[model samples]
Target: MLRELPVALYCGAFAGMTSPLVAGSYSFIILAGLMSGIILAISKTSFHGFGGKLGTIAFGGVCCVSLIIYILN
Candidate 1:
């Protein structure tokens, strides 16, 4: 929850700042952040004891954004 807030904010801000250079697919970054947050939230509740879950969620989120951008462009 609170522990991941900084990471989310940093990732979201970075995504937004660099979005214009990403072939005009800015929304993907925001969506990625939102999706990452959602996935993390779900993972937290579903896999409380799991290890390295945040990293996995973050990677998945970034991968999703990349895929969307690649497909769109």
Candidate 2:
């Protein structure tokens, strides 16, 4: 839990900072961060066999942001 705080913060900040320049989708940024955190937690607990935890979090964040932006536009 505590170990993933930095991951969450980094993902949130990255998404928040880039969302405006990317597409001005602030809501998607927040959603991306939350989704990434949830994914990290779940992956850490359930699927601890591949990609490690940080990789999973980062992948989840990027995928969520991309999906949201694609869907919105």
Candidate 3:
């Protein structure tokens, strides 16, 4: 179970680095995280062997949350 700790820590670091102004709130952060996780899962093979894949995934996650917030507000 603990074998995935490093990946979890890396994901958490990406989330933690998000600015408060952009993240807006803790809930938003959580939502962005979920979005990123979904993106990562769906894109497991699509981006294989590419550099900055995690960063791209993180950016995609933030963008998704931003779009959601934009549409709702």
For residue 37, model 2's alpha carbon misses the true position, in angstroms, by: 0.7
What ordering of candidates by TM-score runs from best to worst?
3, 1, 2
Task: Give the per-residue lDDT digits (tens) of candidate 1, residues 1-73.
Answer: 6887886675455445443555256566668777777776666557677775666676677667778768997
When sorted by lDDT, best at the front, the candidate numbers are: 3, 1, 2
- Give the residue spans of candidate 2 off by over 4 A: 1-7, 14-23, 46-56
Candidate 3 segments exceeding 4 Å error: 1-5
Report the C-alpha lDDT of model 2 over 1-73, residue by residue, as the tens digit.
6886776687556545553555356666667677777766666566555545555575567677788668987
Which window of 10 residues has the lowest lDDT sum in candidate 3? 4-13
TM-score of every candidate relative to the true structure: 0.54, 0.51, 0.82
Task: Please estimate how well model 1 matches the true structure, expressed as its whole-model Cα lDDT.
Answer: 0.64
RMSD of 3: 1.9
Higher-lDDT candidate among 2 and 3? 3
lDDT tens readout by residue for model 3, 25-55: 8888888888887877788669668788777
- Model 3 has a clash total of 0
